[model samples]
Target: YVVEELDVQNSIYEVPLELARQELDVKTLDLLRLDRRTLDLADYLAWLDGVLHPTRECTIAVVGKYIKHQDAYKSIYEALNHAGIANNAKIRFLKVEAEELEKGDPARILKEADGILVPGGFGGRGVPGKVRAVEYARTRKIPFLGICLGMQCAVIEFARNVLGWQDANSTEFDPDTAHAVIDLMAGQRGVTEKGGTMRLGSYPCRFRPGSRSAELYGVSETGERHRHRYEFNPAFRARLAEAGLAATGTSPDDRLVEVVELEADHPYFIGCQFHPEFKSRPRKAHPLFNGLVAAALQHRQGR
Candidate 1:
């Protein structure tokens, strides 16, 4: 298996995915465009109106490793744009180095970001910076999102600080830890090797009652695509909830943790194991993302 490392501060680590032994094997994150799948103009226009704001705009920073490969995250960035069409908010993708925030003030580089997004990545090298990013968002009440590795970092930050899981961490990075916050599925096949081992494509999520996700999707259950190997270890979930972390959504089998949202008291903050950006379309923006952009606009509006 192969592992791709991306960093965020407050913690640093690596993910060792089991990919094929082939030397030429490389797993690069993809960028899919939303127009390819958007079938309705009315839907698109309606969606656009909600996010666009020209006279007044909100600056959103997508902090990640592949910020250079804009095409790879086309759907995500486009969805942001589609949302911005209504609010006239100019969405900007920033190639932020996770290491820079490791011991520095995140506000220095991230201060202007009305919304902060930490996309997926592999390995331990950038985990700490990510945790620090989450902390910065939480403390300052900035709209924050964690996708895949990003999701794991949020959990780790809460586990170690609020829950006091001093040893809390993903075994994929540190197997010797006593409190393994995340781990590989025992019966997990297809992904026994890195490329094919992770559960990919679309899957459904059963949301808890009265959830913003449920409200956004207009239902209690929703489907989304995923690309990851390690999953949230349920053993430590109780601890996370105790620390005010809410497991807002879960998978079909209830074995894997798929979505997490901060308590209602906080501003818009949510993380998911799956990439909602993958399935989003220009006309039909995913609710999670729409909510995120909306929250950012509201932040600037002082509403």
Candidate 2:
């Protein structure tokens, strides 16, 4: 009925609003004598307009193993949209299958991307491809944001290539690798149950005073949700930091690394162990995503 009666271009919210205005009577408000000014939706409509119509565009290559499934990374996709809306740009996702990146040239596949993002995931099936994507983004100075396992891959790539740890890997992928840059949290080793075993829910992260993570967030501390067990092994923190992969955010006690970034020369290379997408909303984009989209716009213009 809406498609046939109302302008097809109207927003879904606008359609309902128009229907109420056209079909419903104002007698109810009149009888109650409620001020009509209270029902003003001008600000909301303007914001909706911005979301529906962006002025610019940027392509983001989302490297992941489950790209074939639409709902697999639904939150990540939606968060990117929110970020795009915040930046006044349409986010065009180039869903590059992680397994495909394992065999294909990442440079060629990702050359057109204004930004590169690798969302959270489990297993080791296409880790090599994800690492390759991280490497490309890091080397090319392209805007990059890695979440959860994506952050782990970023550390592994940096350790292997920059730190000269050729076999650097996450214990989740290589339980016996000599260089376990990423390891299961000490508290999680004894867990046998698959359900409710991983580190989950919101946690506070204290950002380093001058780090990019803190700068982007505009605060020294913030809470972000998590859904992973493996973490940046503290044993390799100094080594990694010496090579430029700095742990810029950590747990309140400084026992766990929550955020990592290469802030020296890179435009925007950040990885967060927590799932920032979980808290993102259309009206307020997460800072990490906001920064990535803004950096992507800059990268696009530079190209």
**Top-lDDT candidate index:** 2
lDDT of 2 by residue, 1-303 (tens): 122233345555666577556634355656788644334455666677778888999999999999999899899989999999889899998999999989999888998999999998889988999999999999999999999999999999999999888999999888999999999777788888855468888999999998999998999999999888789999999989988999999999999999999956989999999999999999999999999999999999999
Candidate 1 steric clashes: 43
| Model 2 clashing residue pairs (backbone) | none
Sliding window of 10 residues with minimal summed lDDT for model 1: 8-17
- Clashes in each model (backbone N, CA, C under 3 Å)? 43, 0
Candidate 2 contains a number of clashing pairs equal to 0
Candidate 2 has a TM-score of: 0.89
| TM-score for each predicted model, relative to the true structure | 0.78, 0.89
Q: Residue 85, candidate 2: how far off, in angstroms? A: 0.9
